[model samples]
Structure formats: structure tokens, C-alpha cells
Target: MSTDVAALTPAEARARFRDGLHVPTSGWCAGYAQANLIIVPKDYAFDTLLFAQRNPKPCPILGVLDAGETTGPLLRGGDIRTDLPAYTVYRDGELVETVTDLSEHWRDDLVTFIVGCSFTFEAPLLQAGIPIAHIDQGCNVPMYRTSIRCESAGRMAGPMVVSMRPIPATRVSDAVRITSRYPAVHGAPVHVGDPSRIGISDLSRPNFGEPVTVPDGTIPVFWACGVTPQAAVMESRPPIAFGHAPGCMLITDAADTDYLIP
Candidate 1:
């Protein structure tokens, strides 16, 4: 809940992340777009890319890196290996560890992919007079794994993931119209109201991220989450894979407006 971190510019924020400030990227660089990170061996790059292509709502590809590359030009000077606050390492479908830096994990055959995060749209929502419960509560957005399955792409396939926000029932349409402007991000609610309809039995406990208070007169809104890639990793079980821990997105230099649809 530090306003100091939230006030930093994208470059300054990334400088801290590079210097070892391991934390979630929410509410930082308020007008900039944040992204989810995923790295896989080149051998599985195609399958991962295909998975993203087939399921853009849950896995919108923001940028992709060639084998062995760490810097991504499309992200406005962000470094793929060190920009994110924390990374989750998986080996043969099992989570092995969560680390802050990827320098030691770097390999010549690794390819990195950046996925659009809903954080990019939060700024606009706030500006548009929509309430974001998690931001107001100063916590990471709640995310859940749903029974809804993603289309298979070679070895990449799994259940779709979603991030939830509590919206005032009166403003649900405004939330949808404003967020739908950014297709590069998740771009709008995939589900609303009851969590059980999407297979989420508990709203108090999320599969990833912290749960928030849903006050009276508010309805739950869900958007396809960037963490969907992790579900794919669990099912695809690539020999090796790496991704950003939920809420710990890569703060990019790109403006939030950059992704807005005209």
C-alpha cells in the first residue's frame, strides 16, 4: 500500500524491479500498460504461440522474443529477463520455484512471450468513474481457474483462467464499454455475477491472487486472465517453462493508450 512505488514512472519502476524489488506490479506507473511474462524453450515456442493465437481472449500476445533474447523492442525499452518482479519456474509440468531474476535461468534455447494484462485497462476504468474493488483495497485482483477449457494447440491446452473485480450493479455496462476498447488487453468481462456458473465454487478463496471484499449492490465481473498461460503449462507440461507469478506483472514503458482500440 505504498504510494511511493505507485508514483514511479515506468522506467523508474523497472529500475527498482531490476535492482531487486520483488513485488506485484499493480497500481504502479498508473497510465502505462503492464504485461504478463512467459518463457519457454524454443522447442515448444510454436505450440505456445499457437495456443495464444487460438485463445486470444485469455492469452493475448503482446510481444514475443526470439530464442536467447532478453530485451523486447515492442515493450518500450523493457528487459524481459529482469523487468518482472518475480518469476515462477516449472519443470515438466510441476512448479519448481519462484525467483526474482532470470539471469541464472537464462538459456540459449529459451523464447519469451509477453501477454496483455488487465491492469492496463484499470486506469481507464478509474478515469471513467468505475470502481475497482481490488485497487481500492490495495490488493492484487482475485483470479480463478474455470471449468471453461481453452482450445488445444499441439501440446498447449488447459482450462481458461479469469481475474475478477467487484463492480457496482449500476455501472456494469459502463465497465464493459470502457474495457472493450482495449482488445490487446483482455478487453471486457467474460463472465459476471455468479462464480459457480464458471466453476468457481468459492469467491473468498481464489486460485491465484488475494481475495477482496464484495460489498452490497456490487456484482462480480470476470475477464479472461493472462495467467491462463500457466494453466496451459500445467497441462502441456513442457520440458521447462517460466512465467510471471500472478499479480507480479512486467511493468512496461508502453502507454495504456497505446493498446486502446480506436
Candidate 2:
């Protein structure tokens, strides 16, 4: 059986991730927000920040680290280079390797960006009595690259990426309402209902994360995803980039409620 992840504190979660436990962060640290990691060479940092600003929905930046720094004030001393359970290294737009730590790959001129993750909204949805299928199934939420293109920022330009969940038709509105309050965490559904409308042919096959069952009477709901930046990396073909493995996020000290809008 899997551990009781939902009950772990942010520190405990980071410890587990740093210790080589590659677990999906869907329901961990229930009231805290999980963040996507992006490490870019100093030369590409400005364009990357611009890319995020232009595409806030898919790339809501929560915190950024100074060049060569491994910790952020809001991340509770967690090392950006090793706190995430797994990381993907991209070399000129191609995935090079997935590793547990960046000690060997760390650079003095690299900057880290922490982007808000959709996982932040999962807890609120469950609190409102909505079921997150992937959590129950012990899998990562399914994600896909859409035909929709993101606005260009310098060398960063590519199609948008989205994460999908199956929400019962009756609770779709509630899910939207709950998520909308957290704009810093990829707010609201970008698309609801037909997957084909967004150029997603098969729900079973996702560009990232795992697919979950879409029960009867439930419709597929899509949200802007942090993976959008990874797609941009592929398009822009930056010399090198580092990002968290899909579903393996950095659990931050910040609370999810900090992102809720009045």
C-alpha cells in the first residue's frame, strides 16, 4: 500500500521527494500548493519569465530563485536542485534524462522558477465533495498538448499544455467556481466536455501524466498546465533546461489559501 501522503507536512513531503521517493503529488500536503520547477540558463531567464507572464494561465510563477541559488524563501529551505523526487533534463529541446538529483548538472548561472501547479486546487475540490479520479487510482493526472498556441516571448513559443480530469456534469460548475478563486494555480477550466475540440484524439494517451477513467455521466475537464513551459522548451530549443518530472512537484511552505482570491 502507498503511504498516507495526504497527511504529510510540507517538510515531510520535501524530505520524501529528496530521498529518492518518486511519488505523484496529487493529494500530498492537502492544504498546501505544489509547484512546478523550471531551471534555465541565465541567458534564457528573461525570455522564460516573459513567456510565463504572457501565458499566466499555464505558467503562473509562484517564486523565483537568484542565479546559482538552490533555496527560496517560500520553499522552506528545500533545495531546488534536489527537493523534487524526479527531474527531466532537456538538451536543445530533446529530453536527455530523468534523474533524482541535479548535483552533477548544477550550474552557477542557472536560475530556478517555481510555477504554481493545478494540484493546489485538488484539495479544495475534494473538500467540496468532488472526487479526483487520479488520486483514488494512485496515478498522476492526465495531461495533453493542445492545438492552442501560447503567445510568444522572445525565444519562447509553443502550443499550450493542459491537465484533464473527469468531472460529473452536475459538479462541473462547482469545480470551476472553486478553482477560479486560485488564479495563481492555473484557474478554471480552459475546456470542458469534448477532448477532440482541443485536438486531443485519445484520452487514454496523454502527452504527460497518467490517464484515468472517465466514468459515466462525467465530462472531461481541462485546465491550463505548468507543462506548457516544457513544450516551449521543445519549440525554442534552448541550449539546456531543467524541470520537475510530470506530477513530481516541490511542496512549498506557502499555503493554498494564500492564493485564494477575495
Measured with C-alpha atoms, the lDDT of residue 243 in candidate 1 is 97
TM-score of each: 0.96, 0.98
**What lDDT score belongs to each candidate, Candidate 1 first?**
0.90, 0.91
RMSD value for candidate 1: 1.3
Which residues of candidate 2, in runs, are more than 4 Å off? 1-3
Q: How many residue pairs clash in each candidate?
A: 0, 0
Q: Under the 3 Å rule for N, CA and C atoms, how many clashes does model 1 have?
A: 0
Per-residue lDDT of 1-262 in model 1, one digit per residue for the tens? 3578768888888888888988778788888899998899999999999999999999999888999988866555767788878899999989999988888989999999999999999888888888888878878889999999999999898999999999999999999999999989999889989999999999999999999999899999999999999988988899899999899998887889999998
Candidate 1 TM-score over all chains jointly? 0.96
